[model samples]
Target: EEASKIVTPNNQSQLEINGGTYATDSWTNVTPKILTHLGMNKHLQQDHPLSIIRQRIVNYFYAAYRNQRGNPLFSVYDKLNPVVTVQQNFDNLLIPSDHVSRQKSDCYYINEQHLLRAHTTAHQVELISGGLDNFLVVGEVYRRDEIDSTHYPVFHQADAVRLVTKDKLFERNPGLELFEETWTGSIANPKRILPSSKFMDQTKQPCHTLEAVKLMEHEMKHVLVGLTKDLFGPRIKYRWVDTYFPFTQPSWELEIYFKDNWLEVLGCGIMRHEILQHAGVHQSIGYAFGLGLERLAMILFDIPDIRLFWSNDSGFLSQFSEQDLQKLTKYKPISHYPQCTNDLSFWLPPDVEVNEGFSPNDFYDLVRSVAGDVVEQISLVDKFKHPKTGKSSVCFRIVYRHMERTMTQAEVNEIHKNIADASVEQFNVQIR
Candidate 1:
């Protein structure tokens, strides 16, 4: 299946992406606007807020963990290819074939068999299979998502994985054993207490021993808590909430109190033993965590709009640095441009199947295709089914505002008209 390719209806011989060419199919939905972001690597730029946060986390791990050779334990891979096979991105991660994330509305598929990864976790199993025990994968991820202050089609993510065997795990705690009924001695924090056995059983995989799971969980939380402290300072308020992921057993999400609201910053848990076994590592237990770089950068730098991270304006780019990361400097707003609001209302095509009907994401993509980043936020202001007619209608409010400059009403009108025309031509909708 991976080797098969279908020519697009346009009859283009090949589509270029990140310096490589590939055959496109009906499944191909990657746009030129999205493709333009492929090699941007904003996370690598020295003065970019995303890059500053990435380096801060990298430095935290380097200082916190050490390998047997007395070197930094977590190897960093920040320049990995954004394109990956379906198997690598989904199957290897234990995601179900029928998962909603596999749909074209959720992911940016390059073809039937390949896609731009939606998360950095796409590389976790491959890295483990290649004999990397502890590593960080940092790169841009793509998705078809709603337009808002915090949501963007492309964003950066950091995924961290660490593996430890019985010998390595017990080596630092010489007196402790893996199967001991209750061993709290290994916990470095004297004030902390282990959870009840019932809780442990509920959180751990049956294949793992309680003692081993506790030790691994403790280490994972210790390192991650330290990371949060390192980035946000020792006084940051945070809590862990139980969560679920396809690739991780005993999953959790960490949320920090920021700006009077609890914001989830990362999701992590013990790596599924089956995943390790599949990677040819039978005797090791590990933990893996993935966090959005933009999420952290926004809190640390007070970045309001997600689009500003991609801004080319010197005012936005010049406000961050490695030094500023230590000081936890807030980003000063450059200028607020006046927003132009336009509403796009249309009725569903009568012949369209319910399951195949146009989605808000389809409309969002159309707006993006016509106006690019000039359109800031899109909201479904009204949606209703017509009485007796069995027809659906939707009204979308698109806020158009440029990050670096004010957009003229005339310019916005033209863009909005283009979006409306494109919607009618593409979805055969009657505009209201």
Candidate 2:
């Protein structure tokens, strides 16, 4: 009975996550609220907006890419475990040991060695090593982030990887040369041309011919562009911006103009040869891409807040359905609940530097620990530096509202007081 307990004192508790029990340590920061979300698998819920968007993408992949037998080429894995080891989450993906993302403040570590994966890319090398050539991994990812309308600690991501051999690359285009100097005639969009630049030069690994790299890049852009068009229609305004990642060379982020703003949709690039070599897959090169499902669903469904995605309210859930997967129906406004606002101000610990000692995310987590999901958004409203003592004081405004019903001012006040007290106790911040 003791072993089956859900939580105990710090470092004494055994957390049961997805049927596996892990001992907690100083690095354990995953909240019970976060743990409870593990099995929700909102992405798999048939009538959920997330599942509808996922299915739409899955359908596009099925119809767009097919093998010789007319079967879908990309296998989908949506049930991968959310918990992963440090090696799988960071080291295997070539993330630097000292990378800022490795900080406990940025990730929900179950312990030093295990954590809720921050991205679906954690399974990339594992799948490749397991002999999957073309695949998609969709799962919930966790992060310690700020409270806002668009950001949530738990969200879903879809990651896709497709590999092609030299023979398979030229199988359809028999006239195409493997070592062609430039790929111009095959691509329909001139804007898709690989520009001559330092970045482009770096992407041309010695292990792959220029023609091979160009072919892969072209195919990747084609598939992604087709996907965006399929989701947003052919008239959607979108562009490709050059970006960098530790695991991929010559990475690019796809941004779409939606709701009068340029919103980034996804990041993709050709797989680094070394990553493939590490996976024991030789003579095959591929491209990998990942996109946040909530970002897309929010835009498609006109969701006003990211927190609404997790709402179990029938009003929110009933607005979406599996039958309307292809329709871009705007989400109807549910009843508008009045918001209660509270402000918290505190001084940074005097002993440490402001930037080194304090992280907003830590304060955000502290508030979350005390208030849970009743708080909708937290914004830094003011910051002051005492000229004499060189001390920093910061103020944040928290907006509290319940999705299902109105939150009474008295109820919000109690939660707000608890959050303020917890902030002081946990962060050593002097209340101001």
Candidate 3:
């Protein structure tokens, strides 16, 4: 079983050392690795001049970072990486294996057989059974990504994995309810807890369900937030959208809006049945997510240039001190204005199909555009044919944020008015 193979020392344990030979380093099953002499240059993977030199430099940086990572203050790091042997493969996360994201045109072709690693997230399935709470993997990743000020072919990824059960401390509180409420745009109903699902546990008993799954999501979110609080403060916002993936069940990408646009960060979901079977983890729940170092560096440092990561530009990196990161530990300053939340509905003729002219969904899109950072969310909370109006009406809740000063009702009203005006002009629909 895959799970057995991971935890038990392989009957065939192999370790490669010093560019020489792989040593069995074990008793019994003692078989010498038969070798033939291969020419010098043929033995090396690349002749690129700076490859070896640069690799050594990165090794030093990694060493220093790991040491600093142990400090109690640095727990939010979440990036835990372990190197793999030549024959090892890290499973791809979120995306389907047969997907174009896995094809040569989109990814680095590692070999005609195996391609360079795309993200550290590939380690998800493999490490699920490893005995650890909130484990993680961090490593250098190679992809064919276009190089730009904000792009790089070779970058780093930090993959964080967490496993929890009904017994954990988080289960006692039922969730970090207090934490969720403190943030604006958070789900306001204090009594309305995150949902869960019913699914089989490792025992093959039928138990998972949508409600339980959401509870797990909430639990994981709380764990991830607490762990990552040092780098990013409290009051994080979650952005969810429909997305597809092979190894996950009900997969979705989660983005948190920070500077301006929704800065997509991590991907997560419950593990797929096939994935659990492959991992030999029967009747168990699984969750996994990956974070891109390049993206985090950009957001944290306001780095518009992605290539700068590999620039070996000492000047660029030296600009920020480890000390500066301490500021991140504090709660992030809220937007100047208190959030203004309002809900509006529109009535349409039953004959009016969304495509016939303008619609409520379209109006919300425009609301999102003009509202920008101010637009917390535009949810189509209610929609149906109006019983009395003899028309279809769509109800939406809008939330706005301001950073400098609390947004006056008038300021919010102005934006609301624009949304209303656009709706009226859009489909000749009346606002209810």
- Model 1, position 19, has a per-residue lDDT of 80
> What lDDT would each prediction earn against the true structure?
0.83, 0.83, 0.46
Per-residue lDDT, model 3, residue 243, is: 53
The per-residue C-alpha lDDT of model 1 at residue 113 equals 90
Q: Estimate each model's TM-score.
A: 0.90, 0.89, 0.46
Candidate numbers sorted by lDDT from highest down: 1, 2, 3
TM-score, structure 2 vs. true: 0.89
Clashes of each: 0, 0, 32
**Candidate 2: tens digits of C-alpha lDDT, residues 1-432:** 221122223446687888888988888988766777888999998689899999999999999999889999999999999999999998887776777889988999999899999999999999999999999999999999988889999999999999887789988777554333453323223234333334444555555677778889999999999999999889999999988776676688999999789999899998866678788887677899999999999988999999988888888888888876777678887888898899988888885444577878867776776777889999989888899988889999999988878988899988887777666666678888
Off by over 4 Å in 1: 1-13, 172-201, 323-325, 353-356
Candidate 3, which segments miss by more than 4 Å at Cα?
A: 1-97, 129-133, 166-207, 225-230, 235-238, 328-432
- TM-score: the better of candidates 2 and 3: 2
User: What is the C-alpha local distance difference test score of candidate 2?
Assistant: 0.83
